[model samples]
Target: MKALKKSIYAEYDVHDAFQKIVLLEMQSYDGTKKQQLKAFLEDMQRSGCISGMISQFIYHADCKKFYIEHLDDLEDIRKEIEDCLGEAVKDRYGLPHYTFMCWLCFEEYCYDIYRNSFE
Candidate 1:
């Protein structure tokens, strides 16, 4: 039983999760912030930056004003995300540069090639 378990985790390469502030804003995407949302999506598409499935929502926030303040910072943050995800995904799928998945960091899922087992 122990030997079997050791074999399973030898290869694992991605798992990324972080507390996101923009997720709160995305919840109301269909409603009031439609215009802003359109612009944000278009900008990302044009820049070939952050693009992926954004589901599994959990928000407990209430604000009369939308989160317009981060408009400037959003581009920088998304560019970082794009860099991390890399262009490999685009080449693999033969898709446009704007297409991407929420792949976690490499270290978290990297296979320990040298290790016989994680002792």
Candidate 2:
């Protein structure tokens, strides 16, 4: 996907946007990959291809070593915690199913609208 092929700065920009929504709405992202997983989980309920999404998010976060040589988004770091949690929950049901799905859809829709507006 073009999004996956994009640079870490692009990924970071997306993550930062996610962080803003999470913070303004009291969402969580405890400084780990767990946030991505959480986003994927919610997405799975709707897309059913969350594993790929989760993988993409993880790769994006992991690539920070290459893209981010100085500072990280403070809110994004917090949300990453769920990315860590997502790893442990792959075999469990601790993830929020429906709410996460709604959130994922809303986030994606918002992202598309925002992206379109920018262009």
Alpha-carbon TM-score of each model against the true structure: 0.22, 0.23
Model 1: weakest 10-residue lDDT segment is 57-66
Q: Runs in model 1 with CA error above 4 Å?
A: 1-32, 50-100, 103-119
TM-score of 1: 0.22
| Candidate achieving the largest TM-score | 2
RMSD of 2: 14.6
The most accurate candidate by lDDT is: 2
User: On a 0 to 100 scale, what is the lDDT of residue 55 in model 2?
Assistant: 31
In candidate 1, what are the lDDT values of residues 28-72, reduced to their tens digit?
556444444443334333432223322321111211011132222
